[model samples]
Target: MLLLIVMVNSCYVPSNLRTVVFSSVNNNVCKRLDGDIVLYAIFVDSKFTNPWSKYDIETTLDSIRVATEWIEQKALEDSVDVHIQVAYHKTLQGRVPIKNDFSKKTLSGTLYKKPLWSGVRDIYKWADKIAKEAGLSMPRDTSPITNIKNDLKNRERLIARLRDHYQTDHVALMYFINNYYSDEISATFDISNDNNVEFSIVSFKNPSVIAHEFLHLFGAYDLYLTQYDVKKRDKKKKDKLMEMFPNEVMAFAHRNLSSLNISDFTKYLIGWKKEMPVEYQRLLLKKGYFTAKY
Candidate 1:
């Protein structure tokens, strides 16, 4: 199992040196700037999702592959030694998600709810059930484990199955939910493992949306302020992304994938850059910012 040991203390890091490591780093699955970061997508169906077909699966997979190519090309121009590997498995059945006035009356009773996760734990547990039965590489089932003996085992098994299949520790698991009639929100939750896998829930098959959410899992932050913004400080950075970098993928996912590219600000968050440029510091943070060492 891969062990992430994080330690933090005040230290002066050299600005331009790629070798200068962080005193404090995020303990998440999508770490490291270089090498292969597996993008293992789990194709799942739901009441709100379109039924999967052989053609839909192939086309969707092709879109995801194209997105990976965009990221790899951007990393190359920026000199970040990284490549994205794609793999996937389709679920045997459709799963339910916890939503207000939807499945709430049933699943909302005891299911965990958090703003960050948006209660995706329910979705993951249900989907893993199918993948596990399919004999595919999936994360360990950590649902309702009351047995004390299995607590530690469940924790270490963390991403055991996925790690085994990829034969590499750096893997970013994603769930691609096919679109039906209504559009669903796409998000990436970084719940740094509490016997769970930190993954992304993608509702649309658009290459831009796929690539944008994938980058979020690795550590990139949304530059454009959205309707989800509630904090006053968050609103302060409103539309700064659009004004500064109109072609940034994180800012506008609706744009053509060829027109969008990753900015230096995103490069730093995903561990591709050593430090943030002084000129672009105010775009996201006001009280200044510390480099989020991954």
Candidate 2:
């Protein structure tokens, strides 16, 4: 009976968690606070032939350290307690080939022959095109658009597997090489990358991308526009992103260390504050941003 009760209590429910709130006093802008924020870093090692080289390992660790430090510093400013955990695992398959010349290599040689989640081929293709356009050397056997979709699907499975194994509430942040198939591979968010797992991907080259996606996991909306419809807009009431909250983190990509800032808008989006920036806060409030039901 006791074991049954423990098991039942361990299961996750949306209502169990309380809404995060930020407090302010006097004229001073107060820091936002929350309970410990847990981070799990997943690394796919099979992408390289020599996955465990000293230099490679050191570089990976250093990158992880830098990312964690950034998160910690920002969390501190917001008065939120952050607890980060990094887990590394090699892919079951051997190294995925690097695709350079399409003519020289066979399709099999240019592909990462791993079990992919459903509905990822399109994403892999998209990521690949983006990488090519960016003038970066394309990986031999991968497509970012398609591969990332598969990876995100796989990442979701990984989280579910972990949750079932440990019986705990664990949020995952996946770190892996972009399959280079799509421009959209920059970042993404979902309740579960697939099923019961909430996961997001961070491109290995752009570490700060994870920061943006994680904000989504915390229930923030994207402030940037991907595609615009000119016909629907009146000149007078444009999107107004630039006019209000110019310093907003969600408004732009944090590609570098310097661009990272915890703005009032972000604090409010994550339920860390009752009052957010006036310009955008009203919309969020109307959309029930302050309401804890979500």
Candidate 3:
């Protein structure tokens, strides 16, 4: 079981916050890779260092357009209907510093030690901060995530508002941070609730990276070797997966989108395919996940 500790008036490490895993992809708001997906982009910039410019925002929008078009094209090739629509909400200034590559401690201390739940909490906390700063009244949801049933009623209400505003059920909250010089890792947070809380914090405006993170919001796992893959067997599997699909978007995400294509494995993950082949079962998630209709 995942232990979620909510500390008050302090930045202390949760004593035992390890043993976290990716929520079932279908549990994310961006459930399927089909139909319409509204990318609710929230642009944030650090006041101390990098700041957002009109040109930067425009370029990032252009990149998002290109990335979405690429994803749509890939979906078409797989005979899946997918239409991406981006909705830029607002540029938040003066308060934006969502930085944490947890090493020995967590955002409060270490990434490795805290893992998914801590990261998820950070995301929620950041979103709450953004909402509060925007003068939106929030209901109390101070409880930590304890079960598959989300305790964060504030998040639910916020998401409902966004959905109603956009007139779409599928909304992927994207936070684009202006931290290009810091070498910060862009992140697609684990699914909090299939109906609402699904988001990615992107640092760069690269089309491929943007598209890769978007796909992750749906279901695609990282095909390339990441620091998260600490197990030797997992590393070997990732290496093999990368070798199998060199130009796969989930594999070489840093590469240009023009050079990359979504693989069958990725297709399955994103719901473009009905089923993942048994041959690649090792790479697919555990049992009870193959059955899906989100």
Candidate 4:
């Protein structure tokens, strides 16, 4: 009976540890104000001959390291501890079967593919598979991944698989490339409440762009809008908002990190600051940009 009791208690200890660890990890991304966070990064290598030489890859990784270190320093100033671990999956190639790469150069001619979500889903699925093959562990919680749609069903499922394998709620899937792809951009997708960041090879090396996209995973929005884009129905409103946040990180990401800071409104959006400023709220409401929930 004594041995039995000890064994049962030992099993319970790990379960309790998991609960505490996962709760802390989820809170770090979902509603972080302070505390340690672990960011999982997976680098996707391109199979095709690419523009990045050995030196470029080395320099890019160096820049990414600098950006992450900067983030840790900034978080420390706000009493938050951040630790980012980058895993390079060189064995995994950035190619989805039966689909062309989602770039203007590839898809502009006759290589265009329909239902773009399918290709995107393939990328996430491939990442999950490669991570498993590499024997990576992830947090196993499906409940936190909310707001998944039919179009995002595969991505949502992959998120669960990755979390279970990683054993942590905070995970980032980065698709790195070496080719001269069109539109060197960094983006983040919020699926089922889980956020993932993706960037091209060039964007990965840019600290400002990396920081801007990183904040998006935490629910920050872009404050800047180009007036020339006819698709923007609320161009005037966005322009007004940009004026309100002249030096905000999301809006001025093309600039150096030293010249920009995360605005209070962005802080509120990411749950860093508790309350949204009244003046900002009034301006948003007057401009028809304010909604009941962020």
Query: Mind giving the per-residue lDDT tens digits that candidate 4 earns over 1-294?
Result: 000000000101113322211111122233342343334444434443254556766776676676667767766666556666554433335322111243333211111235656544554455445445433233333455655521223334444455555555555544444434444344444411324432222234667766676665555666766322355555766787789888887788777777777777777665556566767776444443332322
| Model 1 residue pairs with clashes | none
Query: What's each prediction's TM-score?
Result: 0.72, 0.53, 0.73, 0.61
lDDT of 2 by residue, 1-294 (tens): 000000001112233233323211110111122444445444333332233444555565567666667767777777767655554433344322222222212222222133322223433343333223222211222434543322222444444334433344544444344333333243443331222233344444344555555555554445554332244442222256545655555555544745656566667555566555556544433344342321
User: Candidate 1, 82: how far from true, in Å?
Assistant: 1.7
lDDT of 3 by residue, 128-152 (tens): 5554333243233333653342223
Give the Cα error of residue 111 in candidate 2, in Å: 17
Can you rank all candidates by lDDT, best first?
3, 1, 4, 2
Candidate 2 stretches with Cα past 4 Å from truth are: 1-34, 44-61, 91-157, 160-168, 178-184, 192-196, 228-239, 275-278, 284-294
Model 2, TM vs. native: 0.53
lDDT of candidate 1 over 61-178, digit per residue (tens): 8999999998889889987777788877533453222221223322222123555245455555554554444333244445464443222122124345556557777777676666
**Which structure among the candidates has the greatest lDDT?**
3
Q: Model 1 — TM-score against the truth?
A: 0.72
What are the lDDT scores of the predictions, listed in order? 0.59, 0.41, 0.63, 0.48
User: lDDT of candidate 4?
Assistant: 0.48
Error of 2 at 78 (Å): 2.1
Task: Tell me which of candidates 2 and 4 scores higher on lDDT.
Answer: 4
Error of 1 at 191 (Å): 6.0
